[model samples]
Target: MTAKIIDKHCAQDGDLRPQHLPQNSKTRQLNLFEKALVPQNGLFIFSAILLVVYAIAPAAVYLIAPVGESFLLLSLITICAVTSMLLGSQISLFDSRFKPSAPRLAIDRRVFIAVTWLIFIAFVLITFSTAPSIPIWTALRGGATSNELSQERGEFLKGREGAGIALLYISTFLVNTIVPYSIVLLYRVKSSLRHWAAAVFFLFCISFMQKALFLNLILPLLVFLAITRKLSTKIFLPVIFGTVGLLLLTTALSLAGEGGDTSNTRSSDYLTALYAPSNPIDYFIWRAAAVPIFTATDTLVVHSEQFGSRPLMGATSTLISSILGIERINLERFVFEHQFGGWNDTANSNAVFCIDAYVNFGWPGVVIFGLIIGLTFRWFKISTDIGFQSLWLIFAFVLFSAPLIGMLLSNGFAYMLLHGLYIRVDRHGT
Candidate 1:
């Protein structure tokens, strides 16, 4: 029975050996430090610490160092440190006990392919129906100005009421969730048609001129490859170069479309500055990490009375409000408005997940939120252990991991539903 299972996996993975199987009676035990360093938990722990450092450093410079003491900075740092440590400890503990085994059930390939094509076709139809003359290739290159694209997107969403709105949401969900899963599956199966399907899907998504959609698709694919030990240097290097090249091309296209003079020198300078970091820590803090923490701290100070007054709505504000027949208070939007006066049309106007929690509750909320996310990551790690032979598990882990640094619970429910439906143990196999 063991030999048969090994042969099956070897056939699927193209390389396996009997000696590679886990010993039945004497499985290798990892030490506490080694256990904590497992990739699934360790990466998140490192990220949380990095976020804390970024969050506290600027405040420490401005507040703590000058006067030698700042209670606010000290309190913020303590809360953040505690929250990160709690998360790390939870994740580490969960992963330490996880025992990997072969998957008992395989994906329903026919159903997966059919659903992918149907969704892709729906997306293509929607894009054309909404804006026929917008060349997808041009949009993919970022030739359309942000203003122009935003106006077009508004037109697409304008008058999408009742069933139309519902259909739009369903389509968006499929594109974001199932489509990426399908791509990963296709790649794993070594399907002859995978490349063509991926190209069509990429063009369709890039038509909207949203860089996130591209990253949302590609990053997961890369991570899935890396986790499965299938990522070759040839594939990895090209992907890196391709991503950088795409960004440069898109930036050039956006600059070209602007009314100002489009000079190659300006474009070159932009690329140089982006790659050649003078102050790496400061650059990362300013660009990525500090905004969320700063926003949360500002909220705590400016709107202390409102802090912790409401339940932590996470990401179900709209659904909950709809069901209860109440007005949905968009916490992120409220915070953004408070900080910047109003939403900026050309910029993404949402706070980080931590800030969202802090605003909804307070420091307690941050700790609870961290614990919940840590547990979710642990759940995925354990699920992967049980179904290590399944591509669906890999896809889920990659997809969920992408949003960890930014918004932890935004798509939490949707992902949970997907996992429940598709990734289950096979009673017969067991």
Candidate 2:
């Protein structure tokens, strides 16, 4: 049994798939970390299909809009994603080539610590700085208020003008995009208890309330997965109930006291950034479905024409702004924003990517792009052996949850080329 497993994993040229080793193999323990890092073919196909189904939803919505084509599209996409996942599982069973593994080596703890601290500190600072708040003054450091953001959009809260608030948006995107993503990358690589503690402290100091729940508890859930295999829901659920009960009590008491630290408005905090199962998970799931609906159909045009110049500013503004990027408007925005069109966003933002692909390279682009992304994510997941238990699984989750598919598509494209190039060079040198 051991010999057969080894023979199955070993390449003709004597290379070991860094991520995979058969369960009944003596070498299993030798490849622990590597196996964990490789992406899984099953997960890749599953997630990709989910994404595509989501991407094409807008087309579905129109079809099913009032029991129209929208329902048909949604059903089709869901079936496709699920079918692809099942098929990928069968493919992996027969194909040895797909079962590559990641390398296992302990990282330099000191360097890792330094990098992690830098990332955590930068993350805390950036979150606070960019938080939605009243822009007290432009020169002084504070977030732009919902009202000031409206003026910056050019049209008032309830007005319209086509003067193209392009510059304002470009500015907002630059700040919001760069800061949050940079922090995310930083958090990805960092591993330190002190750094985690500091994050908790900073989250506590922030008045927005929900920030603490996410950064302090949920985001760190990845770390728990990474470090331990002893986790069970038996130990998890009680804690959740306790925490919820505590929060509700505190909120009720705070409301009754009235004269408490009312500096931060409770209503705004509750409505704006509050973390609830319904808010993030439902948002992620429905938003996944919403993407295709928003992108492919004219349903959102009513809201877009209404926003006109400065579209996205506050909570309501951001929601509407997201709708603006759906297929038709995003095409206009892409063309307007970049002048030329590219088949970007095809796999990440659901229908946005498909529409972009259709516009740029026709049906060929859509099918090819979808297949490639779906395959790539699956391969990565299989290689890592992430399954549902690994910290890396969250990366896949986050990628799919993104408002746009640009990140996943571009990352896969760049990673494949770079990795392929490295392999070619190594082969030549050897």
The TM-score obtained by model 1 is 0.65
Badly placed stretches (over 4 Å) of model 1 are: 1-54, 57-61, 64-107, 132-145, 153-162, 232-234, 259-316, 323-325, 335-348, 385-413, 416-430
Q: Best-fitting candidate, measured by TM-score?
A: 1
* Candidate 1 lDDT tens digits, 1-430: 1112112222232212123333531243433432333335543554455355434453554563432222254346445734654564466543333334423344456565676688668766875775535533555555576456555554453325555565445545555656666665555445666677677777666665543356545654554443443344555567767765665554444334455432333322221112222232333333343443454445444344444445444332566566667666555445546665665333333434444455555566667655665555555444442222222232333322222323222433455334533453222223
Task: Give the Cα lDDT of each candidate.
Answer: 0.46, 0.34
Per-residue lDDT tens digits of candidate 2, residues 1-430?
A: 1112112223222122332223444233423332332333336433554555553443444454453443454444444444444444444431333334322232343453355446545644654454444211221233434224323222311122243233233322322222222232233334234344434443432233221223233322322222222123443445446544544432332233122333454332221222121333333443334433444322223223444423222212233336655323443333222211233331112234433333334445445445554554444444322211132333344333232234332223333223322221111232
Predict model 1's lDDT versus the native: 0.46
- In angstroms, the error of model 2 at 305 is 14
Provide the lowest-lDDT 10-residue window in model 1.
1-10
Clashing pairs in 1: none
Report model 2's TM-score to 2 decimal places. Answer: 0.42
